[model samples]
Target: MARDPFATADLEIVGQVTTASNVTLVCGADGVRVVYKPVRGERPLWDFPDGTLAGREVASYLVSDALGWGLIPETILRDGPVGPGMVQRWIEQVRQPVGRPELVDLCPVGEIPEGFREVLRALDGGGRPVSLIHADDPRLRRMAVLDVLLNNADRKGGHALDGADGRVYGVDHGICLHTEPKLRTVLWGWAGEPVEDELLSDITLFVKALPGELGDRLAELITDTEIDALETRGRALLDNPVLPLPQGTRPIPWPAF
Candidate 1:
């Protein structure tokens, strides 16, 4: 196989994502734009081990690729201008029309549109009642399934991008693949709904491939126990084959974005 030019090309930092918790740099490498999350810039979380977030991001991409979902962009763990980090191909988002929702959005309470599922009702900053909802699209449905398989702990609305290429891509997966059940997301719109047959079939094959090349690559990034937990989640999904409801107090990430 030919080497990836994006991996070897020099990355020139163009901007910093100030809103991100960790250091996130937007860089350009040989005309290709990518997001660089250096391991050294990762904030120490009590739950996850230090300097492992970048690897987890890459692992999420690998799993997404193996499932043939293409929900995650091209991602790799490589030495960057700062140090070793996660470098992912940046996706250009498709601009939505005024008052239109992309994947997830907020609307007046009890005014959910057709082909949209309401997740929660809450008071906005103005003390007005509003509902959080997501689209009833197949691409987003696949993303929800991918989150289940990755045991993704953070799937904020902003992470699900409506790409210019007319595909939904999930990003910011540094907090996924933990051994513990830490599934947190705003994709509860499909809770209790049956996963599609085709997706279930794809997941079945993914579970079977877990102990082979995919597993080997993940082993280099996450721990053996995490990989085992990931496989267990996949098998469990195949057994149930349903989108699960939110458990515990905090099901969705705060701020929703």
Candidate 2:
């Protein structure tokens, strides 16, 4: 097989991704657009092992590919302009429709239209009931499923985006694949709903492929123990395919947007 362009291309840092911990850029070449996250630039977190976020990001991509969710953009671990890090293909988001006030902000609880699921409710600065809604989009539903499989610890509202092709693309997965159950996300719309047949089928296939190539790929980015935990989660989901109820007192990320 021909080598992947993302791994072989000469990377150049065109700019910095401010919201990200250690993210940067690769001057796009050969139609390859990517965001680079160097290990050296990673901010250390107490809960996670030091200097492993980049690897975790790559592992997230492997899991996404294995599940055939395509929720994550193409990502790989390679030498970048700064050093070795995770390089992910940049997703060009489609312009969000205007005139939809709720599309980007917290709408009043009473104003939310029917069909939208309320994921968050809080008192705004004015002491009014501010509610956050999750759109009933198929792509978003798929992303929610992917997050559960990865045991994603951060799925803020902003992490999910509408790609140019009308598909949902999820990013910022540097803190996933924890050995413990740490699924915190803003996609509580289907909190108690059973997993769809199509999604379950995908998870089934992923479990079947895990003992071989997929497992090998993940081993390169995470510990053997972490991989085992991932498989355990997959099998459990296969047995009871439902969106896991929120764990811990606080299940949603703060500043949800």
Candidate 3:
């Protein structure tokens, strides 16, 4: 059997992501820069079992790849310096021009940008009124749909990246693909809107592939119950073909960015 270079390359830790909840290390795997999240470093959550987050991250990448969305960077579960972990290609964000609104951002109430949709209206730390908004971008719309399928529990604003390669990527998918519905995210801009025909078609193909190769791959990363839930979500999306509105009190994660 051949070994995957991304999984077999020697990793050299370059830095640590202090802001991350888990022990995230920035490393150079041979010449490839990547983010390494060792399972031993995962913080135990009440809902998810310990040592499972890394696999979930890899599972999210597999689904994203299957959808042909490229919404997530290339990721693999492999042995790193600390032990087995999730290793994902590092995405260098492209810097936006000054005064340009980000993919997700805050704008003054009533002054929402033309291509943006307001998700929330609230006061800033300075007591100034502002609206939480995201761009009406097809790339982002695809990501929102992916999040729905994965039942992504946390999609913070910081997780969406505008890559230097001119693509949007989502990261930090450690808490996803649970059997329970846990679709918290910052992308409610297209809530209740009918999904575009092309995206739906892609999803149609994804659902069909679920019981075959994709299912087998996901079974290795997540439980059978989670895979079944994923299929159910995909079928539901196809039946409705509409972006869901925020549900429950905490549809969006706290400290969104």
Candidate 4:
């Protein structure tokens, strides 16, 4: 993919972001928080592949939209030292610890509070539901579930940020949405459990709503095979069963607070 080049002046670097190489949280001209990746004369992973990352970012963004609000970021723009880096919505940090911090500390669920059962129960399953488990606010669950499916290897406690604005956010896509099950996550204990009905219904609706133009737009970044896989996964999520969770299990990541 051809990278869209931009000058450094294009973004407003805000704070420091470690874990990944050459990353700096920056606000773009559009006033969106984006992690700036600098591509220079170096290896693909080390320097930056420019458009490749941007394109992948776009694909993830598209899938998030399909899943509902759970997967959200502002948009991917071609603004970086060498080319277009990923741009995303900044979720405000959750100020209070809503659940038990100990359980999360023992395990790891992307910064999710332990004993969040009550909070999960209170959510609404998006009315435009699917067959399997889903959440009332499809958007929030979308992000959490996709983070699991994508196997965002970096979805550690801190990465699973609490956007104080009534939402959650996931970041660091350096390792996500792979071909394999690669499901190394904090939410694994919940596997084989019953998915929420309302959430499943939402997934079905979300898939049917996929736009045609998006196919073409995504073609520029990922392969036809990747797109097809995502579709298949969406179906699988919809068809998933709703088994009651086993003892000592968690469907999503526990906050590693």
Considering every candidate listed, which one attains the maximal TM-score?
A: 1
Candidate 2 lDDT over residue span 211-234, tens digit each: 899999888888888889898998
**Model 3, 1-257: lDDT tens per residue?**
96665778899999999999999999997788999999999999999873389999999999999989999999998899999999999999989899899999999999998999899999999999999999888899899999999999999999999999999999999999988878999999889999889989999999999999899999898998888989999999999999898889899988898
Clashing residue pairs for model 1 = none
lDDT of 1: 0.92
The lowest-lDDT stretch of 10 consecutive residues in candidate 2 is: 96-105
TM-score of each: 0.97, 0.92, 0.96, 0.65
Alpha-carbon shift of residue 191 in model 4 (angstroms) = 1.9
Per-residue lDDT tens digits for candidate 1, residues 1-257, read 86566888889999999999999999998888999999999988999973389999999999999999999999998888899999999999999998787789999998998999999999999999999999998999999999998888899999999999999999999999988888999999889999999998998899899999989999899999999999999989888989988999988998789
C-alpha local distance difference test of each model: 0.92, 0.81, 0.92, 0.50
**RMSD of every prediction:** 1.3, 2.1, 1.6, 9.9
Off by over 4 Å in 1: 1-3
Q: Lowest summed lDDT over 10 consecutive residues: which window, candidate 3?
A: 1-10
lDDT of 4 by residue, 124-166 (tens): 2344321112123334444556764454544454555556676
User: How do the candidates rank by TM-score, highest first?
Assistant: 1, 3, 2, 4
Native-vs-model 2 lDDT? 0.81
